[model samples]
Target: MAAEPNETAQVNEIQKEYTRIDKDWLSLHYKISIGMVLFALAVECIMGLILVNTDMLNTTVPKFVFKFILVPSGVNGLCAVIDHMVVKSEKISQTAKIYTVSIINTVICFSLFTAHSAFTVTYYVFVTAIILTTVYASYLVTLSTSVSGLALLVISELFITWDVDKPTIFQSTLRLGNFLIALFIMFSVSMICMVVIHYEKRKNRASIRIEEERITLTKRLKMDELTGIYNRKALHDAMRDLEDCNPQDNYIFGITDIDKFKNINDSWGHQTGDKCLIAFAQLLKSNCIKANVYRYGGDEFCIIFHHTDINEAYETAVLIQDQLKKVEFKEYPELQMTASFGLAQYGSGMNAARLFMSADQALYQAKITRDAIRIHEKEI
Candidate 1:
């Protein structure tokens, strides 16, 4: 039952599409959240600055501070908003983390400016806020973001202390007294938080990878190796699951058997036989809408339908078999393929296994006639 080249290629294309859609969904969520956070931070900064610099403070705003801090922070915030919009449009996830860090850095700028103003005591609040931001970043790219945050902190210190007296030297000289100790404490906390965040991110990533592998393995297990249809094992599970459910009136069961399959293999070799099977499976997959198709065994296939009547199932089978006219083998130009179908519907008491057995018996009757459709009740 090894798949034909065309069928295999089609399956690969479908898998790739599934992966792309999944990636885009995750990217959309992250991008929207990033955009919201950036917008909120920008509003807070713009409004807070305007209020603080206004007569509400009853003091003249420092022009140098406004020029140095407000302009840079606003531009940074705007860049985050633009980056977020780009992510939304392009569905790109690679730059999401970088944009997040830039947004957080704007908040850091606001803190630096506040600390340099009359509220030098707000440095404690800034220290706490920055530590939290760095921890969030550690979850994204632990070591890299942590290093960038450290560099940004250094830059902020330079900006605040520029053109000021030398008394505020908290690093190396420790002239800021206990504030230098507080700085050391903050750095220590940041390092420890980053390590914790790093480990958590590593573990989460490993878990996600394991889960993805498990899903792939589960799919492979259920699929037939040759034809890419559900294998007998999956059929067994599907039947058992149906047995556990409440009986429904609209379920239809069907079986398809390749006509003169042994003669086909003997005449054209096993490779061509495989091509025929792949072609049939591909056809069933395409046309068996609202039904679960399985490779029962050998040259036998099955379709179980939900909410379908016996006549609808029969019409579908006829339509699918008629497509056999178009099936062309490269080596055998004169060969035509056909399948006999057995159709049945479930009653209130019938389990899926019983339902399919009835269909199997009908399929056997169809096989006797060669290329025919037989209702299980008609055979009985």
Candidate 2:
């Protein structure tokens, strides 16, 4: 089924907000990638210094320094630069950003492994890299990066013999078996991360749906069931808004009533009276663009004009009264109707109650005249 118009609008707003948040997250991820690379560079330089001080290298000083220190640092810097370029590209998709970042992290980890190939602990750096990819919460990125890093590890193990002695076939098989076990554990970690991400996304969607329903319900409660305009409850809310109005701002209140509306209900029936009320509401809605129209009760309707002078509000009411006279009901063509209006303007220190009572008094005068307009001049 198609969504309601309001629901469609809400969805569009949500999509726009999500796009903004996604961009911010991507930028943060890029900065984190840069920090990680810098951290890797620092670790490499420190380890190289420690190894040099211990005189642990089997090779010459220059060879050890060049292979362990310079090469690893260069790889870190190069990966950081590549990540910078990818994040700066406006046309790149968010998925592409995640893919690039995950690959760069793996490469940095691999370079560190290359420098310390003899150390069994350094081999586990690949596992750490795979686990870090889970930070993006992307299943595809984690899976693909894990598989690629495992493949590189297998290839490196084949040619790069860590020990001085040539391993027998059984020893080689045992090493390969250990690699297989590590691969299984890495895949399991990736699966768990994906499941947690899925659960979080589902929970967020449910919360959003509940919030939308609440907003829709609030709107329904504020609206008149028959005329679909603001109801009496909404008018009370509007009155509360008066306290926040600026002192320089002009506010006009108008109370309008259909003259002898009871006669229409008595002569024609309540259904025709309802139709007349709906038509009057439409007239108010179409004519008073800058005002809020409310169904006060029965045939009495209220209008609160924002930032409008009393004269302007009075003129609008007159125009509505004239137009209401011309409205022809299809069910009862011979019937004619006219409405009375009472207007009052808010003054300094005047509260919403005072303004409404002033308008109501004027409405009483207009009702006595029947099919006329009146204004209450008292501001206090």
Candidate 3:
């Protein structure tokens, strides 16, 4: 099934974050691999010294050099080359990079197993590599690496002879059976890790859904349902924001009212009056691109202009009044409308309330003339 656009967007955001996390993990893995190689070299050197001193060495000295020294070094060198290629190349897919890391880890662990075949404890390296793959939080990578590790363990059992004490065929069979039990345990751990990762991703998706809903609800609360402009609540919020803003920034506030709006309701009914209000709000929204328009109350509107010229604001008010006069109400073609507007510019040290009061005062003067525009004069 196709995802909804919003859901798709959310998923994209989550994937991007995971990509960043994977990149960091890749870097850490590279650094740790270098350290592990150094440690492995040190252990092999010590083991060689102990075999020589204790006279427990079974293989020729040159064969021992090839097996213990050269083989491990070649494997480590190959890993370094692959790591550099995968990490630096931009063309490699993200899935490929993750798989490369898992493969490298498996190969390194297998190398350790082959180097110390006599030590049954080295078999646990496969299990360790499987567990480390879980940090990527990818079920596919974890499962694939687990299967690969199991395969390598079985191959080592069949082909490679461990230099343990001479034992009967029955004892070797019993040891192989024990290793099979260990494989079962490794597979179980991988399943558990996959389940945990699946649940974590589900939880993250739920969180994203809840946050999206909250933002949608907030927008609805701030919007006017009737006319689709901002509501009085939004205007109040804007006023508070203006109060908190730098006092030196210039602002202009305008309050407007449809002239004789109550008479329109009385003569043509409230429904017709609603139509007029909606049309007026639409005009303001479409024309007043520089300002935020709000439905302050019944038949009244408010605008806040940031850093606008008083003359420009006054001219915009006139244009709105002219535009309103030209609108033909199809329901009542005989009906004509005009709006009165009052504008006030911000002054230093003036609070939002004071600035609002000044615009309201100008609105009162405009109302006296009816269908007029008035600019509040700053007090000397």
Candidate number with greatest lDDT: 3
Give the lDDT of residue 243 in candidate 1: 65
Write down the worst ten-residue block by lDDT for model 1.
1-10
After superposition, the stretches of candidate 1 with alpha carbons farther than 4 Å from their true spots are 1-127, 130-177, 184-188, 378-380
Q: List the residue pairs that clash in candidate 2.
A: none
Candidate 3 pairs with clashing backbones? none
- TM-score, model 2 to reference: 0.77
Off by over 4 Å in 3: 1-35, 77-103, 133-135, 140-171, 247-251, 288-290, 306-329, 370-373, 378-380
lDDT of 2 by residue, 35-78 (tens): 86677678767876787788665667787677767777788789
lDDT of each prediction vs. the true structure?
0.66, 0.77, 0.80
List where candidate 2 sits over 4 angstroms from the true fold: 1-32, 53-56, 81-103, 113-171, 378-380
User: Candidate 1 versus the native: TM-score?
Assistant: 0.60
Rank list by TM-score: 2, 3, 1
Tell me the lDDT of model 3 at 167.
39
